[model samples]
Target: MTRTATSAHPLDVALELEPVGDGTVTGRTTAAYANMVGPFGGITAATMLSAALRHPERLGDPVSLTVNFAGPVADGPFTIDARPTRTNNSTQHWTIEMTQDGVVATTATAVFALRRDSWTSTEVAPPAAPGAESVEPTPGPEFIRWMSNYDMRFVDGGLTDIDGERGDSTTTLWIRDNPARALDFPGLTAMCDSFYPRVFLRRGQMCPAGTVSLTIYFHVDADTLSEQGDDAVLATARAQHFGRSYFDQSAELWGRGGALLATSHQVMYFKV
Candidate 1:
């Protein structure tokens, strides 16, 4: 069965890619998913990943993904060209480029590998923050349409106090899709970049900031995502360093019972 954008989740609708053959796809940005400066970076990343996922040559599931935002993606039509650069017995590598008006706007690389039963362990401890029900829903910025897509309960480190009162760049929150869509790899990938840019939490004011590059390592497979359903997941994000022009953010997403789903890192460009 073929899936169309209108029949899919809003996120999927926003990232809907039409196969154009020859390892290329076409997509469009929706106003409903627009962010402060442009479309949310997360959605763009997911869209780029979708190109590879939908490709006829794709193998296995995504294990790692890295997206680089080279320029602003204009709303409306865009094109993604994905090619399998390498293919191993149990893994595949892809390079994707997104362009608008014939100019490159984003590029990404992905590694897909088949999962195997093996020894596993989680070393990082989950934060002892209050449960999602204990915290009130945090209001999202009205100008950012994509903000309304998620229900967020902040346990700590939110954008509410952008005046440096908090003094640190740590944000812990519980988040789930607003319409309660089932959890999946594409959704998880979007969530990994969903944390508000660290600048707001650190400086207490909005500044010109955008993600330059983002990387996510998936820890769970398809079965794990299906088990998560539509439940809220705990997300913790913090900045390691904020320099004059750029900063780095590290984050983790954990499912119920402290199962780590993904780990993400990104470098952001900020202007005073």
Candidate 2:
């Protein structure tokens, strides 16, 4: 029997939230978006940010966000509580948490700022990797449900090797929603977390690994986002250091025409 695809984009379905009053919102994890251990970390992060975006008192747009995965989030329903800790004339700060079974599973803080015309420049260069059409799409593992939702064309560093032969932890790929959805903050937020853990690329084998914390800085404004529409973005991620049970990965997402859209960093937990 053929499986029927979900009509709503996985990101959209995962981010669907219901307000429960007092700055609280609730959502559930969809099986179509599951990771090895739980829901993909990126979706969860976006869900947390969604609470803040949906908050009645929110101001402006997301400038920077930090999410801490305090514990594993089980499948089923979860709750997010967001509060504006402070608000200023041009900026706003918020604190958010996700809870499952009455236990805090994730916590996050975000800063939103109103943009104004100012001196703008980017010193970071765009990816020198081959164009997306020149490379083959990276095949995702069958166990990772979320991979099916994206079309990932890799220039280098994919899940191809798993026997400690690849020698480095760097991945460059072009990614976008599989069914082609327009770019938005929540969608961009989830894409930042889409890259597989660097450990899988370096070790050439799945060693228990997961992101413990993730942070992203948005560089583009709403107008820029609308211009992106459904086009693929180039993303490159590499590990800064790996020691003991933790390591750090940094990534940059570039939109069409080579405009830098966002930068992300994460600390991951791995078992030896």
Candidate 3:
């Protein structure tokens, strides 16, 4: 079946949650984004963020978010709680949790703030590359269903080998929703986690892997976000350290005209 069969975009469907009363909501896992062991971590992260976004008490846009995966989220229904831990004149803090069968599965914290005009500058330069159109789009591995949801045109460090050569785990790509949905905060949050595990690119092989914790810092204010439409964003990621069991991944997402949208950091578990 096509992703639009339900009329709602696949992402909206993936992030869908139902009101269960008392300021909580319930959601279910979708086959569209199923991973090897559970649902895609990005979708889960976005869902938890959605909890905060959907709350009526929410203030301003998101500035930062951190999701901790405590356990695998089995395919089924799960509950989420978004509580405003603290709120100030210009900022708000939140604590969110996801649970299945009354057992905690995921936990997250987020901060939202009303942005004001101020001096702005980007200390880092964007990577030099041709526009996204000039590059050829690569098909996602069929095994990972969620990858197909994106139109990914990689500039370098693609998943073209499994046992080839070991090298730096850096990937630069232009990406957007496959069907071209309009850009939004939750959508941007989802895209931040869309890259392949850095370990795969560095080791030139696939291993049992998953994100342990994912964090995103949004540099976008309301004006900047409104300027971003459906255009593909330039994204780049690399691994800073690979230890015996875990590796660290850092990434940046840039909108058109070198607009630094967000920067993210994540840790992943790996076993050779």
List lDDT for all candidates, in order: 0.89, 0.88, 0.89
**Candidate 3 lDDT (Cα, 0 to 1):** 0.89
Cα error of candidate 1 at position 163, Å: 2.9
Candidate 1's clash total is: 2
How far off is residue 182 in model 3, in Å?
1.0
Model 2 Cα lDDT, one tens digit per residue, 177-202: 87778888888999999987798878
For all candidates, the clash counts are: 2, 3, 0
Better of 1 and 3 by TM-score: 3
TM-score of 1: 0.95
What is the number of residue pairs that collide in model 3? Answer: 0
Tens-place lDDT per residue, model 1, 1-272, is 11233456788689778888899999899887898767999899989888998899999899999999999988889999999999999999999999998899999999999889999999998887888878898879798899798889988887676665456888899998877788888889889999988888877888888999999999988887789988899999999998889999999999978899999999999986
lDDT of 1: 0.89
Give lDDT tens digits, candidate 3, residues 55-111: 989899999999999999999999999999999999999999999999999999999
Give the runs in model 1 whose Cα sits over 4 Å from its true position: 1-7
